[model samples]
Target: MFFIMTISNRKKQYIETVEKNITKITQYTIFNRTFRHNDRKFHKFLVEPDLNVLVVGIGNGDLLASLNPAVGVGIDISQKMVEFAAKKYQSLNFIHHDIDNKIDILKHPIVGKQKFDVVILSDQIGLCDDIQKTFENIQALCHSNTRLIISYYTKHWEWLLKLAEAVGLKVKQPEQNLLSTTDIEKIAELSGFEVIRKEYRQFIPFPLLGLDIVFNKFFGTLPGFRRLCLRTYVVARPHQTHEKKPYSATVVIPCRNEKGNIESAIKRLPQFCDNIEIIYVEGHSKDGTWEEVLRVKEAYPDLNIKAFQQTGKGKADAVHLAFSKATGDVFMILDADLTVPPEQLPKFYQVISSGQGDFVNGTRLIYPMEDQAMRFLNFLANKTFSWLFSYLLSQRFTDTLCGTKVFLGSDYKRIMKQREFFGDFDPFGDFELIFGASKLNMKVVEVPIRYQARSYGETQISRFRHGVILLRMVVHAYKKLKFSV
Candidate 1:
């Protein structure tokens, strides 16, 4: 009985301290407008519009309102903060609940027993009484596909933040738990979440016209500098329960001039799935590749095979056309050159069917390549772009130019709908899929494969021209993805 009483007293004291700090900050924000810029930066990178969001530690509901979630609910422990938020943002629902204690989120009238697409802890995880318990409570509001986005300050900036607070540059922070990224990841794992992507941002919070753009947009994302950034963001999802379910696979082979390898490519493909569909998208091949595809389809009568002559130029157009007609649950791309072997298709299928990753890409850099498979200049270019794209997408990729890529059919349709945003610049088709997968917040996984030299014909790629095109695409991505509002 004494221990229970002491626990209750501690809870009461913690709540009172948080309440006092929140009240003081609310007053401070009303007078000082620049303080809210920090929240705006967090909103810019993390929050997307039209999601069903439940923001914990939603102070004044500003960040929650800014996201424009279709179903928005903001929660805070302080009643005064809830009241203020309710009045300021009349459209959003505000709840006054202590997250540390056991509370049924579904039972809340405003939330209406609905599962949210996104559950955001924001900067409030530091203030929670039990971080693991808080995450456990959040699990009730999530489904398998639900994403949890967390933003917190790096412990490196603790002294600088304290100085800012003392000098009246920032709001007075309450006594809170300072957590590192690894610490948060452990807590998330213990509470049934899997970390997907991690990023660091905001080298300078104060806005300057040209300098802020250069520092935050370019310099802050660099390797060594990013570690010292003021904020850290992590994207995670619930640990999924996998079941044995049969999935159909479609292999899209984009061919331009590989006539000699067509029959071998068809014969070498292993029967790995319950149902396999082979699609030959012949891109106006001058070497009778389309005729060879038709002959192969007729010869392999037992196999489900379809052939199409692409009316448009480039591999991207061919992929888009083939994907539009694809019927299988899993969509895969295999270059007709047979650089990455058809035998490796099973590994891609297993990754997707077992729920390991939503988008699986082939990596040629890991395993040794066959003699004359890739030139020295090409290898160096691949390495350079891989680093650039890894930073741009916040996902690590060793070989982004690998033609072998796999994803779901439904996701392909969604990506096709938004393809106009990036334009028809990607002739290779690899970046389009990679960029789209990253934009949709899909888990990207890479499988290493041996790169083989093509025996049928000469390579179609022009090194210098394609390198310039890739650089242009990167700049476009920066504007569309990194610098966007």
Candidate 2:
């Protein structure tokens, strides 16, 4: 009973200490302001605007207000901090509750039955006595689509942070949980959350005459240097149980000069789902591919096949045209060259339909390819670009140039809406989808497919020419994704 009372008293003291220092901790010093601004910028990048956002441990409510959430709710342990935030940010809802000890936060009258699209726990997980329990408690306020962002300072910066606090450069507070990124990941898993991605930011906590921007954006983002970053974030979602459903699939085959493979493409593709629609967008093929498409459609009258002559040039244009006409729930891309066999498309369909992944990409590099499937120079280029792109996109991509990519029609529409952001620069059509998926924070999953040598068509890829284009796209992505403010 004595030990129990001591624990209860310690909790009360922690709350009181935080409540008393609310105003002081949030004071707008130049250094404090810079840190907060950088943090807000990073959070804004991770979270899309116009979302229903719930900010746990919202101190002074500045971060929540900056996000401009559609429905913003801020919760904190200290009543004084909550009251202060409520008075300042009248537009957003604020609640005072102990996340570690209290009942479901959703049980509060103000937030009843409201599920958030994004749940932010910025630097708040450290304040919880039981981080796992805190995560479990917050799950009540989330839906399957909700994205939970947890940010905290890395332990490597503890000494520097303490020195700053001692010298009055930053706010000093009670002892925190101070768990490592691995510890936090494990705790989140225990609390029924699956981590999507991890990001490290803010190598220099204070702005030092614009060097902060240069170092943080370029030098700090390097693979080795990122480990020493002051701040780390883990993006997660509620662990979901996916069951296969009867989702209709639209297989869009963008053919350029594949007359020999047109009929074979139709015959080999199995009926993977109940309602399958095959769209063939012939891109001005010199080998009579368009004529073959027409003949195949006439011959296979029972199959739901639609053929169209592409009005524009390049594979990207043809793909965009077919995607616009796609009628099924899911959209699939199968290159008419027949390098990635049409038979393996079922694996792609199952992944997307079963909710195993949001953006399913075929990886030809995983399985042993046929001897003549890929040229030596092209194979080396693919390997190099795969690693480079995976780093740039924050997702594992084994084969970036794979023609067999699958995603939902709804997601493809969302990508189309934001096409202006990246511009219609990609002629090959792969980077557009890849970049769009990364921008939308979609889970990119790769499926290994046996790459077969083309039986009829020659490889259209010009190593030197397309290699330059890929390099240009990499530069553009760095500017938009990593280097951008």
Candidate 3:
């Protein structure tokens, strides 16, 4: 009975706080404006354009409205906040429901029998009487593919927030539990959700002469300073237990001046799946590589093979062309130079088909390479950049330059749509997919592969020139992914 009474009192306090601060909450001051705007941009990045989204503790409904979801529903404990939000954004549906009272969210008819693509619990988890129970309630509203995004303030800012409230610079709130990112992840785990990505932002919440962007983008993302940030965002999805069925595969081999390996690329490949299509995207080669691709397609009439000539230069263009024409459930990239063996393609296919990962990347650094597989400087650069990218994306990546990558065709379409966020910067096509996968919050898993020396063609890579371009891409990615708005 005492526990029930305590929960009732907490609910009363939250309602009272919202009734008192409804007007003040909507009227954003410079500090609150900057903070909320920054948050909106981050959430916008986390959410795709046209998804069904549910926002818990949907305060004034500003965040939900910003996402441009196909269908948006918001639930809050405060009736006044709900009414105000409904009146403000009549297009979005808002409901007055107490999440702390162990209410099943699916019981509501408006949201009944409907699963969201993204379920957001923003800044309200700390206020819940039982965080575990709150996540359990939310579990009913999620499908396997649904992404749960939670945002909360770091506990280290408790005193500062109290000071701000004392000075009337911030809205006062009821006393609540302060949870760290780890605490939230563990709590969500108990409810059968696994965190896929985590991020820290806003070292300085207010814009102080443009230094906010500089510090938040560069300094706030660094190792020591990131933990001190004001906000933490976590993206999670429902843990999968069921096994996935096999998916047909498309291997896109982009060849340039590799006439000798055209036919072998087909013969050496293992029949990894029931249905496999091989596409030879031949760039303008002087050694009759295009003719060899045609000859190989004719020679291997038993195999499902197609050939295309690149209308534009660079590997990125060739990849985009092949992806456009690809007719398989999953897409795989194989370098024509065959540094990464064709026999290992099944490992890549198995990882994606079994739902072990969303983006399967091949890592040459994991296993010992054959002699002269990669230059010493190239090897050093790959190691250096892998660590840097892992830090940048908040996901582990061992070899960013690996020629073999696999992902579902459906996800590749979404990544292509999200490619405009980073623009056309990657000439090699690896970073394009890597950055896109990270942006889309896809689970990236690396498969170890033994690197072999190229027997037919010379390496088309220039370490100095490409290394400089890669550095530029890092800076570009930082601005897009870390420092925005």
Candidate 4:
């Protein structure tokens, strides 16, 4: 039919256009140099050494090689580009195909039928004829835990880019789709993907040494400044199906001079799983908190309880010791003061067991707190730290100081293995788990909980002293997580 022929002709024309522009751009060194720099920036966020990566627009194969994924697969519409990539990087598999069209991705022998851990669309979404269909096609290559990373230029930079092209600093290209961050998000939603985080970066594309570091690393992450950045990135994943199986849990209570609340905590904690293991890591309490823990363990003979006296000084050390002794599929941290209710533990457990998120953090900022639950200055500090950490980690977190955090036992072990990177700096054990979960590319979900006034002895935290410690950790995280890559 004529309609079928017209559709075939359009496909041929689109492919020809892409191939011609791609082949032409190969001759420009300045253009390629700029792209190489952009590739490195994307590499820092998308690629981890242990992941399996599938890059949709693998132009020169530099991005794929930079990632160093265990299993790397690259695909492109241009046969010339595919040939160049295949010959240059003999280790990685390069295929000549149009991602806009639906194809059996499992047909490839090298990639096999297994789903990839990360699926990347590196500045190529703009060239697709049907962006939603393009995203839908790649669903076959993803698992529930897979992260889809998309990077593209903001429309605000369109004029500047054209000027660069006019001056021969950049390569000329055919007109492509110009999509804003919100537009791309909507397309992704229609394609069965949910956006987890959105970030803007690269205020200065040219390397200017100290100036570059200050602008991109420090000032670029700021609120109003980040909106003007050249590049925008969205991290998304497939909508997961909830699992209906029961899981065991371990609630770790790192108590340090909370003798009055020990028995109350044990009694009020709800049983949500097949088995609930309670671990008490009593720090060098000036009060008789360790003795109280031992007494409670003997009195509550029906409950699964274990107690340990921490040899180390800080709460982080106590948690590290307790986690080592924990025996459960789900690991959790509950403050002994009972600020966040023990009954809320079931909500955290349900989130992880249902495949909702890998790291579930409790947020106290959403609900109204009890009278005198937190000091005015302390509340202000929590708000300030939340914004700083959300920017630092590229994930939205409202209450970073909340002590109730939960994750799988397997993930906790992996985090402990990489703890040397951050060192023994976190006294509260909050940032250790948060930064670890972010580094592993895990889904982080925040659950709102009521904050109650402490019924025990005086608070152990020194407001000014711990505040200084938190600021130091932020700078340390900036160096290790933001700039190190």
Candidate 5:
């Protein structure tokens, strides 16, 4: 009986001490970059600006403050943590609120008519009794492009955590309704959302403080670490593609010459996948390209093909013009050259449905290309840029300029607002897509497919001049996304 009473007292003390330490986490913000990296890979790569946001946990989040949010909201069940954080970052909005109580997310005035650009729920998923309801409510709380970055501890960390609780250094709250990474993905996907990025990290961020970095890192890096890691960070966004109510997609194909492949391309492309509308933005072509596009449109009236002529002569210019005319939940870029087949578009569609990634890109490197498809000099540049971008963007992209990319329409809006950041210089539309996708923290995944050299037309990408321009983009991204962020 005496031992039981002692254990109960220790548990109480553990909660109290954790509440105190959390209140003063500004001291740990220096170490928080590593924390952010472990949560979102590209965040540490510094390709993104600090995200301005709110966290529904104990204390004001210094991590959010570092991002220069227009307003930051930090809430916690404990008044002690709220009070401490209030004094720390008094410039930002900090609220003392109990997450344990019933939350009518829609009823909240801050999100009633207005939703946050980003919302965070860190280290407090287990405190809420209704896990599904909590997320469903959070779903209601978000605008279309709103990003939610959440971190949580799982059952696998329970033993070590309980020991820390006994030592009065940690708190083990009751398992209200614990969930796995896959569980959360399913919940989000079913609720018109998808996991943009999911990471299992830091069994213990503070090695000397808790489990020690060695054992923590080992388990954290393990396969399915979500099965054992002390924490998980999941970034979810609205998956624009769904069956409940079919949404529209604008497939923009920019072609300059390449009449040889037009007939095959039109025939091979997916006719209808869920309200897909095909638009051909034909640039100035020396060949009979306009005639071919017209013939194809006449052949397939059911495809909803609209052919538009652009006065400008660049890929980015063509894309921009077509995008202004697009009215869809999703957008796609299909090169008129048809190096990558249109048949593979369903795979890109599947990527959106899977919720594993947000931006779908065609990767020609994974599959062998036809003879003379990529010249040696161009191949060298491709390899160099692939490595450079993977490091610069914190996302793996096997092909940087494959002429095929897709993303949600809402994300496009977010990118459009930040378009001035990367003026109108990208002729191939590669840098623009990559830069914007990384900025929004969208997970960019490669969809491997075969590549055939262009069947017609000369390549507009100058071997030397454009190569230098491309190189400059890389250096600029390093300065903007990497070092600055």
Candidate 6:
């Protein structure tokens, strides 16, 4: 009985010693150690704007200051750490709360609401005796939108980490984790968060017995190459966004006088496109384009429908007005003339869903088109532009003037922000998406959709008048993105 009592007592003391060592490291080593300038490693860990933030293991408060000014609070079990951070960033809120002492991070006012845009564990996670429990407490503070940034000592550093511990120097490490990259991921998921990005920095993040500080400086700039990348930095968010079922797309058809075509276009659209809401932008025209769109929308109430007028005369202007009303993960433009049919829109949707490319474009020239639809002169112009663009972009651009185009709405917003760089020159809107796609480096997938000529209403394109403008826009794109810095 005495022998068992002795062993139990020793084990308890041993655990206490490890806990004390961690608290000391949490307060001093992370915050007190600073470079001539701020540590670039810590600064790079901050990837997003911290509109509202919480520092889970607020060691030295160094990480908090580097981020965008945010309403933030920091908590550390160690009183010394709370005092240190308070003294440094007087503007910040620092309080002492032990992770193991029934003090969940989520219970804190700033965290409980999960209102933070970013929640940082930083090197603070290294000091925990129970890394998984600490991770769960941090996870509750993250909403579906929050970004959690964390890093910890790799298990491969066990020898050096033990040496640091022996010398009474603060060693930040995962709790006896022998942690591999996969281990980190499992723990994050168990804690109700999903790892979004995992980046390995370098093999050796610190100065070794043989390698000099100069080698460390060189590895820092190499960004790509390195051996002992110390710890992996994980950027994780809640997996709920990936789990939500995708919604069907909104297809916008801009109609002028294509009356004979509407009923067929409505029927031929694929079954997956059943939930597709078709909004027709009807510009003022002599034919009953408005009445025809109303007829199609009535036939398919399963497709939520809205029709509006385009005061401006161009297709580009019509797309701009139609898009203001679109709500879909995928936004597609279909010409009402059936040059590009509604059936082809499903392939575009599938291309995006399969993650083959962000933007799907229709290529009319891939297979020969109906001869009557494209006149001999228009054919020559299309061929010339296709060859020129393919050469310029170093990608197979089979057709540059095809009216049908498809893309994700979010990516479009990014491209649109800089649209003024290429002034609104193309009335067709084909070059605008092409130019934006080239600028964004978006993988452009050309789906071969059959093109048939309009059986009614005159073709809107003015070949001779638009040809000079198309040539000028290509020159402009070359100067702005390709040849310039």
TM-score of each candidate structure, all chains considered together: 0.90, 0.95, 0.95, 0.91, 0.66, 0.51
* Local accuracy of candidate 4 as per-residue lDDT tens digits, 170-213: 66655768999999999999999988878777777666755865
Model 6 per-residue lDDT tens digits across residues 78-191: 555567778889987776665433344445564455467676775555455666777776655566556777766556777876777677564433345467767778888887
Better TM-score candidate (4, 5): 4
Please give the ranking of all candidate structures by TM-score, highest first, separated by commas. 3, 2, 4, 1, 5, 6
What's the distance in Å from true for residue 446, model 4? 1.9
* C-alpha RMSD for every candidate: 3.5, 3.0, 2.6, 3.4, 8.1, 10.5
Q: Can you tell me which runs of candidate 1 are displaced by over 4 Å?
A: 1-38, 41-48, 109-112, 208-210, 417-424, 479-485
Candidate 1 local accuracy as lDDT? 0.81
Cα TM-score of candidate 4: 0.91
Task: Evaluate all candidate structures by whole-model CA lDDT and list the values in order.
Answer: 0.81, 0.84, 0.87, 0.82, 0.67, 0.65
lDDT, residue 404, candidate 2: 90
Error of 3 at 173 (Å): 2.1
lDDT, candidate 5, at 239: 57
Minimal lDDT window, size 10, model 4? 1-10
Best by lDDT: 3
Q: Is candidate 2 or candidate 6 better by TM-score?
A: 2
Higher-lDDT candidate of 1 and 6:
1
Number of the candidate with higher lDDT, 4 or 6: 4
Query: Which should have the higher lDDT, number 3 or number 4?
Result: 3
Worst 10 residues of 2 by lDDT: 1-10
List model 5 lDDT by residue over 356-433, tens digit each.
567898888887889988898888888889988876665677789788898777778878766766565567777888
